[model samples]
Structure formats: C-alpha cells, structure tokens
Target: MQRRGLLLILSSPSGAGKSTLARRLMGWDPTIRFSVSATTRAPRPGEEDGREYYFRSRAQFEAMIADQQMLEHAEVFGNLYGSPRGPVEAAMAEGRDTLFDIDWQGGQQIRNSALGRDVVSVFVLPPSIAELDRRLRGRAQDSEEVIAGRMAKSRDEISHWAEYDYVLVNDDIDRSFKQLQTILEAERMRRDRQPALTDFVRGLNREFEQR
Candidate 1:
C-alpha cells in the first residue's frame, strides 16, 4: 500500500505573513510543491516562463476555461489567473503534497472539487487590525492610496476566517510556524492518507500469531 498526497491551502489578509510561513514550511519540507498558477499578464523583469507563472494570452486562457483545463480561476484587477489541473494531478499521484497560497475563493474552489477530501485548509490572521496596518506600512513599497485599498480589502478577507479547518493568529512568526509544522505532521499521519498502514498492521498480526 501507498500514501496519497494532500493539498495544503493557506489563506490570509494582505499583511498577515502567510507568504512568510509558506516559505518557511517549504524550507522545512522540500518535498512539498508550490502550486504555480497561469496568468494572462505579461512576465515582469527576471520572471521566467513556467517558473513564476505560465503566461498566456487572454484568448488562450479563455480556451483553457472552455476546455475545463483550469482547476480554479478568477479575475483579479481585470486580469485572469488560474491553477492548471494537469501538474497538480500529476503531483498528487506521485505522493507529493501541493501548497496553495491563495485567497478564500480559490481555496473554496479547490476544497469543493473532485479531490476535496484531500484538502487541509488553514487561515492566518493578524494579531490585531492595528498590527496589520503597521505591517502593511512597514513594507514601504505601497503608497497611502494602495495601503488604504489593501486595508479595506483586508476586512473582507478576514471575514472568511471561519471557512478554514485551522485558524492561526500570527502574533509571532516562530510560534505560528511551529503550529503550522505540527498541523502538517498530524495531517500526514491520518489513517486515510497512509494506505500502507493496512498492510503493516496485517504483517504485525501475522508475526504475533506465529510467535
């Protein structure tokens, strides 16, 4: 018997440090593959094709949607982005876990799909609204207008916290990361995922009877 892979979905508001935890998680476990999405937007400087995204023309993307090739898709800022169904399915069959750093909408789509049972969703929240604002400002990459827009959107994002299986308030990075790791460890040990356990237990029973 073998084990099936899991789909780990992580969602958070703009400044809640979801990406940081995701990076640390991957660093902790190199076998987990990050789900690369396809976008209709052009690649930015130093961004390679098929690495950051599978950049496609709008027509190409629309065709994929019509052909039912996308696992999940949504329009953002007038641009289309979607996760490809092929690579993700391939990874799953190979027993390699996939990590999705997506919003609640994408997470919901994945969780409601044919492979829904394999999904383990987590939502990361900021310690407080003031701390979230401070984290956004501390980045120094956004203007006041952009920050305000993000803060507005954060309210909507935070409202979906109850949708996830696990919710972590990221008051400290180390503590949050440890909790995330623990979740992964426990999820991996679930009886359904470890199909080999059946055979292992059968062998144990046979050996004990012979003794």
Candidate 2:
C-alpha cells in the first residue's frame, strides 16, 4: 500500500538522550529525513552552513517569520530558531518522513498547524531529576552555570510530557531506543497513513466474489 510519511517530533529536557536516540533512529532507517532548522545564531566551530543549520542573518530570519515561511519559530537564549515550512511540505509530498528535534513549544505549534495530523509527538524523560542532573554534568560540554540554568528549566520542560502521544523514560538508552522504534512502527501502520489500503481491500473483495 502507498504510505504517507509522518512528522516525528522528539522532545526532552536538555540533558535527556533525545539527540542520541534520534541518531540511532536515523541509522536504523536511512530514508528518515532530518528536518534542518534555520537559526539566527552564528554557527559554531566545525559547523557547516546548510548542514548544521540554515544560518541566516537576524534580518533575513525575521523576514521569513513575517512572510509565514516558518512552520514553528521560537526565541531561546536570545537566538531565534525555526523550521522552514516549504521544505517540510515538500518532503511530505514526496512521501519522506521528517524527524524534528524540537522543544514542546515548537511541537505544539507544528501540531496546531494545517499539517498537524501528520505529526506524531514523543516526549523523552529522564529516570529522575537527580539522574537528569547527573546526565547534564556528565556531558561536560556546558559550564556549571549553564548546567544550573538548564536544571532550573528541566521541570518546565518535563511539565508538558503529557502533551505528547508517546512518553518514554530514557533510563537505559538501549531500551528507550527499542520503545521509540516500536512507536514509530506502530504509527506508520495506522490505517489512515496507508492511502493504498482502500484499493487492496477492494481487490480482496472482488477475488472473494469470483471464488
């Protein structure tokens, strides 16, 4: 049956393993397209322009927002980040599933848009608040000050867990990945997503009549 694609939205607090799980998912299925975001923030070291983000000047990004080119946009830490509506729609039209690593706010906006039905939101949670802090400290990529700031925001992020269709506690990466995969597989199997199923059922009916 011809199948339509899903817009998979994976969100979690800063220290959660959403990024790692996203990588594993893409590795599991190469056809899953990663939604590249547009950002007004300057690219970091070793980051490519279009590969990491579609880097834009503040003026350009604002222009896109004004023109309604962004599917979901938000400001964080004084930087503006958003997903472009055009590319996402194009990917959906081509039957390619797009994966988004966005926060709950962006998730809400996307799910409220015209393409809302195509979205499947998942929220990943840490096993515990203490464990969440531990994971953040383990990364060592951010300063202690930054970690503290993130910790303060963790509760806020976790509060919206129920908004997602699926909620996973990322206590163990392996198990979490398995659950994530199962969710995707099940969502893909939903009857509405398989547009060709109508024809297949009709064929079966005709064959039964001939018999």
Expressed as tens digits, the lDDT of each residue in 35-143 for candidate 1 is 9999999899999889899999999999999988888899999999998888888888888899999998898898898879999999999999999999999999888
lDDT of 2 by residue, 97-167 (tens): 89999998999999999889999999999999999988888878788898878888888989999999999
> Which regions in candidate 1 have their CA more than 4 angstroms from the true location?
201-211
Model 2 weakest 10-residue run by lDDT: 87-96
RMSD of each: 1.9, 1.8
CA lDDT for candidate 1? 0.93
Q: Give the TM-score comparing model 1 with the true structure, all chains together.
A: 0.93
CA lDDT scores, all candidates in order? 0.93, 0.92
lDDT for model 2: 0.92
Error at 116, model 1, angstroms: 0.8
Q: List the residue pairs that clash in candidate 1.
A: none
The per-residue C-alpha lDDT of model 2 at residue 118 equals 95
